[model samples]
Target: MNFKGKSLSLKEYNDLADILQNKYGMQFLGDYEALCSNIAAGKEEEKNQAKPEPVIKQGQGDEEKAVFIRGTIRSGQLIRSEGNIVVLGDVNPGAYLEAAGSITVMGKMRGTGHAGTQGDYSTYIAAFRLEPMQLRIGDIVTRPPDGKQYKSKVPEMAFVKKGMIIVEPYLGKR
Candidate 1:
């Protein structure tokens, strides 16, 4: 009865509904679109209402805390972590992320990523495709140049350099 942990398209949902009704004699209360919308709304509500729990793991000689996210961050969502943060998906526009440690995105970043939120300038933000609306490290911030477009789809890293946030293409092993 629960569809959690599964990603299904409209057609797939409809097919499942049909199978359930025909084979199991189970009746669905709402239409396909309505059901999907309700599920999405519920998820958004849960995210908005839920509080982030601290994650702790044993490191080489101490305990390290990090937050890991596996899905795209939509607009209006804010992800704040007391330690490092790693996102496996893209960060959409209007979304925000603040972390006391480094922030890493396995996909594109088009939102605001504020690393070193606790004033640790050594922290950095790295993404597979960096085209963020804003990048912040400690007290420094950087934005895309006016009327400038980055054509390369290479990975990039941003860090505080000389009191300013500098973003450069990530070569290997930095």
Candidate 2:
């Protein structure tokens, strides 16, 4: 399907793909690079159609607030928040998430998550099933060791410890 001149969001694209796959049995054959390019083009078109507005100054209280998102984050999508972020659904591969504060995924996480984007080393990332492609906290970045796999799919949390990222099972009510 040609998406040129169309401004469909990532979720819309995912929904369309699902319908095509399930109903028509046609798989989307585009690569990640092509999908990203299409998304970028749609965003650019949206920016051109919308008028510029003055930057809104956020109060100190807003910095402590959290952003909540519902639904799966598919590939070629990016999510960012100034404060904490909580996703109610899975974060699929090729998706990116960034939060200045902490990040919590209620479902599986199989994408890139960057916490402490504003240099808050104390920020952390938590997920029901942690299988991230890459992770970052503050200025440090890490990935699973080559060929390393977790035996258990338990809920886990990641945080910076002694300048290194550490992942551990989430023990309740610590």
Q: Which candidate number would show the highest lDDT if scored against the true structure?
A: 2
Error (Å) of candidate 1 at residue 42 is: 38
Q: Per-residue lDDT for 10-29 in model 2, tens only?
A: 68778877898899998776
Model 2 worst lDDT window (10 residues): 53-62
Candidate 1, residue 52: how far the Cα is off, in Å: 15
Candidate lDDT scores, in order, read: 0.81, 0.82
lDDT against true structure, model 2: 0.82
- The worst-scoring run of ten residues by lDDT in candidate 1 lies at 54-63
Q: lDDT by residue for model 1 over 1-174, one digit each (tens)?
A: 545546568898789879989999988655777777877987897799787454432221111556899999989899987788899999999999998888999998989999887778888899999888889988888888879765447899998788988888888755
